[model samples]
Target: MNKKTIITILIALVAMAGQAQKHLPAFQYSKEPAVLSGQIIGNNQQITESVHVRYSLKYTSGMGDALRQTSAAVDADGRFTLSLPTGTTVDCHVAVGECRFICYVVPGQTVTFTLDLNKLETQGLANALTFSGQLSDFNHDLVYATEQGIDPETIYRDIEAKRNMGQLANELPEKSEQGYFHYLDSTYQRVNELIDNDREIGQAYREFAKAVNRYEWGAMMPFCGQSIQYAGIDTDEAYDAFEARLKQRLEVYMKDDPWANPVLCYVMWSMPETFVDSYVSHPVKLPTDYQQCHLASKFLEQMGAQRFLLTEVQKDSVLTFLPELAQDVLDYNERMERELSFVSEQGMSRVCTLPDNADDILATILKPYNGKPVLLDLWETTCGPCRLAFKDMHDKKKDLADRIHFVNIASENSDLATWQRLIPNYIGDHYRLTKQQLQSLHSQLPCNTSGVPIWVLINADGTIHHAFTGWRNVDDMMKEINQVLQ
Candidate 1:
């Protein structure tokens, strides 16, 4: 090869190597391109504060746990900055204790969040699974899946669409025996017919229970491990068989794939709380010792990255295994944290907030954005009211954007094009986040927007200046913003 070509190839190789490094180390900012500089602040110093946070994918996929050992600390001035994975729809939390907070992450934007302390939670799964709308989706999806016998995605989207049509939660379809799944409608009819007929999915358990009776231990293990929600109609015979089979499943899973599906096992165990109580506490219990609990916690700690499905009790039970796990969970708490400070609420500076790393840009945001009365307008493409509100607000942007930070957040579905077309100027320095990200953001605010076209205004001190929902709330919203800014 010519010298010139050889030199050119070497340069190209170096550039490729540089690009390759970007995806490694997961949350490495350059290695993983991300929105920068998240901040959490506390209003009253005398009142210790705590904030919670989680990251997520917009759709029903999985999420990454974002408590960075290096970036986990809250700041002295009551701010914490954190970096999220590239392409992550991140959620942040703010709370004092068991009470809930509001969410405020930008849709699809790499994030920098600021929250106050009055809006944090410190107990239970309700405190941990900080994603707000996710449960609504879960409940809606479960009921729809049972009724329609369809995949969770289709059911989830159906619920969203119904919401757009302004349907109430009660108005949605319920678990119907005669729907497409149970009766006849789709290719899955035959498969649906084979599952347990009992409403509680106990019928499926009965077959497995009978298998246990016949000493089909191998087959019974799977029955115990399978999703219990799908199980219908529990019986005494079924419960006993489930216990027998599940004991075997737990043994096998704990031995081999303990971390493989921690949430599923926990959920499975929780299915028949009554039966599991009897089974586990049976004369032949799971050693009736804390060591086993330690083992279970180890599995959970190792699998914390994909812990969206884990309940608080499950997470706590596992963390109780080792002191370090408890420390880490405690560490996740950001106290009176500067939304952009170095030390976390736990009083450790080991973890850094988003601003800690990208100080320059963060400083820029805080310079003028701080303490300035700001109005955050949240809307998505799929939301008709959100679109209408966007258009309505768009008419006033010339007067608003320069005075207050008016951000139009695109929901994850906005990328689908169909959702995008409804809104004008699908351009600009817009912040996009998934519903999960939005929910995570909600973990910080005093109030959250259950429906779109919501307005959240905050003062430079991070006090929630005013919060409201609805297009009609716009006038009141404007007044609040003006008062806060003035």
Candidate 2:
């Protein structure tokens, strides 16, 4: 063969090879699944040898829909495969453990990693090891960027400390914006530097991260908009100035979707209720009507029908006022119901009866399990710490099953359907109560704050023995329970 012919044939072969390498099949929904595998090294003697690696895997459907969480499990070392439906981007996390990581997976992809618990706690996973798969570099970038972001507590403290300055309440309108923007700008610069310097990170993730940053920063605007200095005074001049300032501040987010800008959207969503008549023309009363005026509707309009509908659904207020605007969203939800299916392997949870209030709780619920000391787990469905506490206490509950009565009381604000669905995952006596009831019960208990999952221990004599909040480890809980028992 001639030299030219050979060269052309070689070029053609390379092109064909490239095509073959890139030709991944279209996602087959549930027909195929993705796998996540990893090994945990440096497991101390205290840590279980074969730990249950459970995670709540949240992902978005390819069709641009709401996020969903699927419960997944794998042995700490048994390839730790995660089989998920196709065309999803997953954020995986152990209930309370620090194995939180994000990855975009398609059907038939196997993403793998090794986590060193010791290094993970101190140096973070970004410094510990490398992640491998198509989305590995993107995932790594996310970790690196997050590791470099400013600590939220620092900013919170700076803003809050000013409250003691006495002048800060008056200076809030001017000072908060400067402080907020300073931190936000610094965060933006740091993340942008990482993105620009890294070639491995994809353009898609870079864009997404930018959106997330904007949304986070946007949420703080509401606090900045409020006039703490002039708490109850009603002035037309102050009102006009506040409205103008808020409108000016919101220019950046005017075009963004409510979901993408959840914080800002939520503040705007609440404006109607909190600042009623503040938006009406020739407002005679409130001074900050502009902040409440037409902003939510404008945001809803910019979010378009689908996003608006989903936002309303999340607020649990759809079909109340925005039915005309939500026809498309309703249709989309219906379509998803038909097209998607989940095959959950969660076993049947032991059913427990729910009592009405603290009165009924003492009379019927607690009275029934009279002999055993009760550990009241006050939790709600959406509380992250609450979920983590429950997950961490799982094994302890199984071991200490006979010693104590585990009573889980969910706040009334929790979705009843979701509460019922999730209760099966937990082992305990379950009950639901309103905020009024929770406070009434708290007054009678040892707890100081209304926050949950508040642990309230009832002595065998039916008197309050102890109450604490936050994720108290298994050992701490055992010590408390045993102390009460003694």
Candidate 3:
């Protein structure tokens, strides 16, 4: 080829490259904290004043115990800034009153946006309102897609319905394995097309969104099948065929580096026991790169604990599988150990005698701590959320240990042995009541609902200050406690 012809071709190639780069911006990951700052640009005073940014952090697959939350408050002028502790990228939600919308955030970067409460309330549109700074293109595309009727919440609701009702209520014409797989494939293709066709989406976010959609679609089979088994409708032959097909689909999906997205890690970790067992028995060979190896180690660690109690040998076995990533695995485990050391070395168990009369149960339980305010926690050993709340409040409880009396009450529904074994991790005055006694106690209290993890705040003079069900954050709990204390 002549020099003139070669030079012309090189120039044309450079132009093409630049055009492609314009459509797909480069993204770099960092460990530094990411800042999300925004303003409410509407006339809704209630929403602007109450807005908060909250997101769950899942660094590992054992999220039930490992999950942590980060939240930030908005000021009177409708401006708010939240620092997200992330190494890679994370999906977070911006909550205003009862409504919330999703946003993508990365470490060491600032994402600025505005929320129009009027538009959000009337039309339910939470698109950028106004977007700027890093990841503006990505967030705009995400919110745009969601508004156009392609939303993850729709997919999640379908999966949830199948789990609860034993069948798919939307989209699927048939309930068979083939039909379910078809639904997954069709939904995934639609989402994929939406991301691919949008020239506005950056390369990093496009990849992450695709990975998240793929994993969620792939996970539905096992998740739904497990629910069916629990409902006693699933058979060995059907489930085996379903598992085999799912494994095959995953093989193709894994090639795309799906685990690179940390959001997908939450999906993987949420898999049912049956799925985890199947994966352990018939393991798929993952990429041997640093991120892949570290993810594999965390997966095994979580699965081992979920399937059965993990011993030292079992943990060592995880390292053996990823010898090259041994240090990474060790570091993750050490960090997790430090975070989860909620079990107190010094026993905080206080033995309490139960009154014979069913009606006297509440009075007798509160008799010992007469002059001090008491936070009575009604929970059960079998309740997963109850245990999670205990872990979340452990540190906060210690800080307020001297100011107030923290008491725990359980009923016959919780096994005695299990209750005894778990209470050491929960430092408080413990009481196990008979079923009738618990019923009577609930009747006496102003409980909104009959549920576990109920909170009853008693004044120092033994009057019931407040009674409510479900878990509240430490700040909210302290606020209520302080009112009674004053």
Candidate 4:
């Protein structure tokens, strides 16, 4: 090689090596552990005793395997220290006793902070505490920004209330779109200001949070947009415009950072739901055109989004549409198979039938209140709405404590620990069934759906009077309960 060319190559190699080192600063700490120490105080500003503290440090965005969890127990003086993985941005959840606080972090740098239990108790444990450390200020600001951002529940509740009052304007669809977009714009402005002005935030977390925030904003828009209804926005021309604009915005986010967010994957998987207003009543096939088919195929390949479809119905729809993505379906089945095998190996035998021993499992479960009416709840620990519904009717259940037998049967997939923690909050009898047993029981039900939380009301005569999925229609549910009581 020429001397000049060799010199040029050496210079280029040196520059590349410098850039590579910048990206891998965390690897240096692999040999030397990173420490996160903190102190906890109660409402009286005194050190809390015997507090159990824990936190899960996970990649800001990735598969389940990227999780690194650490925890520590606070002494009588309320001081504790824990080790954490350094380098990448992690979504950190810190717990003190029963109160938990969430914050983001890049762990190599020393972190020291004090949490005020007084503020946590009054404000509620969600994103209320701030942090102080090398990158913690920016992380704290991001958490604050998240708190200030528009709440989806507030928006939905307003819409429902407006609808009920018949005071919704015909232009609400347009207004709702504006409201959501404005929120996104405001959040972006705040984040950008923090990144530009905060010298210590560092480039790695800056880039990660920017991409994540943008994608999440875009992901939330469709739901907000579709919820807008006063005058119909479902007309073909209107919906097509809305859909096109959404796709255009998503394309921008995808171009900037494809792997940094799961929002794109969610949008792709939810494509079928977009047609609910227009084509739901009329039977239609997926990937209805070449353009859609191409988009769906590309997104599936890019996001590996097949794991999002946990239900049989969702899997069936995808398999029917894009035959080429059959491997994703197979992978999910294999995962379920492994889970089943592991459960069995743990001595968790799944009995499918109520044993011929009238002392049979199902029979024994229901035999206590044989003549009285029973309201059966089929749910899982992961089901948020189920928990909400149960809590919402806690008072009502207490009032009816003498009249109805509230029996809750948790799905096999629920962890025993989680079930134990949550079951006590509900006033009822609780039983847990394995996935095999749950499926077998479901076969006897008259409904065709396979989602929870499913509620079934049994008449005083011990016959099933009503059954349904979801916990939204409390009034309808109450009507059935009253009918069964009568």
Candidate 5:
């Protein structure tokens, strides 16, 4: 062969190899940890305020469990590293300061990225971020797809809106089933078109994106035409008939094997408890995938929490159904039980004696910390979001322990024993109030008492500084707390 011809053939061969290598390999579950390291290019003040890169994992157990967070501190130079323990490819929201974006983390791989804080602040688009290393293609594709409006959250919200208000409304039992099915098919086709148009995304990512869309629709399918009020199923007979129809639809849906992919957990994360319970009780045959087994075990784990303990029978059933995950299930149960037992035994120390008078409870609770800014957390043990919030704030609370007086208050609605048991896990001044005392405090405070996880900021001078409900990130809370401190 001529020299030029040989050189051309070699170059063509190399190009073909590069093209083949660009396609991502199929996902394999692993116990090994994944490393995510990155640098934030921004001013020192913005970097300093960005304390931690926080990401949470939701696996088989669902949202009933306390959110499992893996965080790494950002140094003075705006560099951060996180070692995430994931068994499969999972979606995570990597948040630093006010900037947050969805990224996929794969087991046993390192994905490095750079966050341009200036661009994130100015444009508020994560597409400006750059990524490299293993699994970088997946992350890049995810961000690009999200930016282009192919986001799972957006699609889910659109579906929900149509289900609630449009012709696809679950409440409209008389709506044509074929029409609804057509809508789902069209939505999937649109998503596929977006994926097809994106020539940059790999084959594995394309499949993952489509799987997410299918599973999300499957998750919501069981509720179609099953709204109790809309169906007018007031009697037991009618209720039974309605349930049977729903089960039939669900079984048909499950035939597609929606749970085969471990990554579907992302779509299922925000699903309501009722939906999960219905899924677990459905008579459809289970998938043989180990991820499916693990998810089933996690669902059982949540069910076990209803009584605050997993019974021996329940554990045995888990072992029987999920033999592949037998040891894992047992170890998780034992570890959780041990942690609960330890915390329950180590009851919290009261910072001050309760006032004999029940009136003005808020004033009485703040009397001990008159000159220190107090961040009052109102929560209950049975509340999942409340406990999750506490877990999220654990490290942040410790960092501010000396600077702020953290007080936690619970009412009679929460079990006294349970309250004592969990309070030790959160290091703060604890108080259990009577129903009447709680009502009195609510009347005095400006915050909304409609929820359990309420946060009230008490100024150093013993006056209300701020009050809000629900969970807030550490940086946002710090901003308000700093104002009160200054």
Candidate 6:
């Protein structure tokens, strides 16, 4: 053979060898969709898991529908099969990391994942994303998590769980923030689904959302307060009709549904008049028609919800009569203060409860650190900034050791033994509190201690001089501390 022919044969051999070495299957789903099979391995039978696979479309990018499939018990040997979407690429991942599996399917396909129960529990609280994606961008993340298909509703609901739990509240209006609106819109849409049977309810929610989004909290608050008054004046108005519709719908939806958060859409629907009526610049005295204006509040109160929150989200609602409410808030503080005093008597405790209120949380925390400025560092086992901040604080202690009191606080959820081991001979006051105790304490001492690496200048005067909100703002903290010292 000629040299050229020999070279051609060599090229063929190289190409064939590359094909053989490919780790993924060569089949294309767009043409020949088939079942992907897998088995879950575990050390024992009790370790078995039900795997859920979320599939996404490849070419459409992440916008394509994401579908999910589940498998029966892997044979005692851990085996199962899942059918893939035909004529398209799909990717699948387990929900909540419920169980791990190695997917064997067409290569070059897009995929996404759903949170398994554990993951769902971990993130669904306070409205967080249950799953993370390997992709870089939001779209890619969505695609990677559910390349086959996904229930936008489920994703939104999971987000709602996080939001209600306060985990997703800080994510502003952006793509990473899509989960917020996604859940909001999805919630409104679901309520609308129920509204199909009850237009009155639909109209009310739509109006609530409209007012909330366009108008400030002031307008909606009083309007609802007045709605209650008007409700009493005219018991037969559409407002009453809508209220009935809303409650009926809620009875059906609240079960297995997280509704602590109202969708921006539904919130808009609740108060349309906000757009038409200007907010009161100053505290507007209730018109002589005050009783009339607040008929809705009375009605709702009668209905057993005005006290709940839907109607009283802002001060303007009942604050037309401020002295009373202010007194209540103050009294609540007094009660909390007493609690904090009790806590102060019992220093170095564990934080265990998620708070019922944001107010007075600081005083509660301060009880133990009373008279001594505490370097309250809320570090978790996995917090990175906290570790850095703790070390930095420790290093600085030599200078302000006498003036500032430092306490390394962790959640009560942490294993005390494990924490002791991690810190080893930890001399500083170590404290823990439930979600509740931490929150209540923080609210009173909102020096900006929103997240961990929190540094506070609690003076001997029983007044907080400054609070640093997040570890990211550590420099701000340094400045504040300097100001306090000066």
Backbone clash count, each prediction separately: 63, 1, 0, 0, 0, 89
Give each prediction's root-mean-square deviation over alpha carbons.
24.1, 12.3, 6.8, 14.4, 7.4, 23.4
lDDT of 4 by residue, 1-486 (tens): 999999999999987754542321221212234566777766434445543333432211112222355667777667787767533334465666666455444445666667777776677433446556644554454444445433222333454465456554353434566655665556556656655565544444455445444544554555555444524566889877877766665555445344323323212322333433332223333222222334334433222211222456645665776454445434644664464344335433222224434323444556677889999888887776676566456556767877998888887698887776555445677778766667666766667547888887877766778888888645767888899888
Which of the two, 1 or 5, has more TM-score? 5
Q: Write the per-residue lDDT of candidate 3 for residues 1-486, one digit (tens) a residue.
A: 999999999999987754552332322235587788888766655454555565544334442534435666677778888777654455677776666677767678898888776777676664426667876766766676566655555556666776677556344676555666676778778878877887756565565567667766766655545442222336898657766767676656555555444445433434333234445434443223334434543553453223223358756875676454445446655654644354354445565668575357778888889999999999987776677677667777777788899999998898887777666557788888887887888888887646778999999999999998987566788889899878
lDDT of 1 by residue, 171-284 (tens): 524332222122212322333443334344332222322222222222223332222222543687866765565565444423432222222221121122223333343322
Q: Lowest summed-lDDT stretch of 10 residues in model 5? A: 58-67
Sort by TM-score, best first: what order? 3, 5, 2, 4, 6, 1
Best candidate (score: lDDT)? 5
The C-alpha lDDT values of all candidates are 0.39, 0.52, 0.65, 0.54, 0.67, 0.42
| TM-scores for every predicted model | 0.26, 0.46, 0.65, 0.42, 0.61, 0.27
Q: Model 6 misses residue 281 by how many Å?
A: 69
Ranking by lDDT: 5, 3, 4, 2, 6, 1
TM-score for candidate 6, please give it.
Answer: 0.27
- At residue 206, candidate 4 shows an lDDT of 51
Determine which window of 10 residues in candidate 4 has minimal summed lDDT. Answer: 57-66
**Native-to-model Cα distance after best TM-score fit, residue 181 in candidate 3, in Å:** 6.2
lDDT of 5 by residue, 24-116 (tens): 544445678777888888887776444343344434443234244767778877788888876655667777777667776777888888888
Off by over 4 Å in 4: 1-35, 41-45, 50-71, 83-89, 97-101, 105-111, 114-209, 230-232, 236-238, 258-451, 454-486
- Model 5: CA > 4 A from native: 1-32, 37-54, 58-88, 92-101, 112-133, 158-202, 222-242, 262-276, 279-377, 389-441, 455-467, 473-486
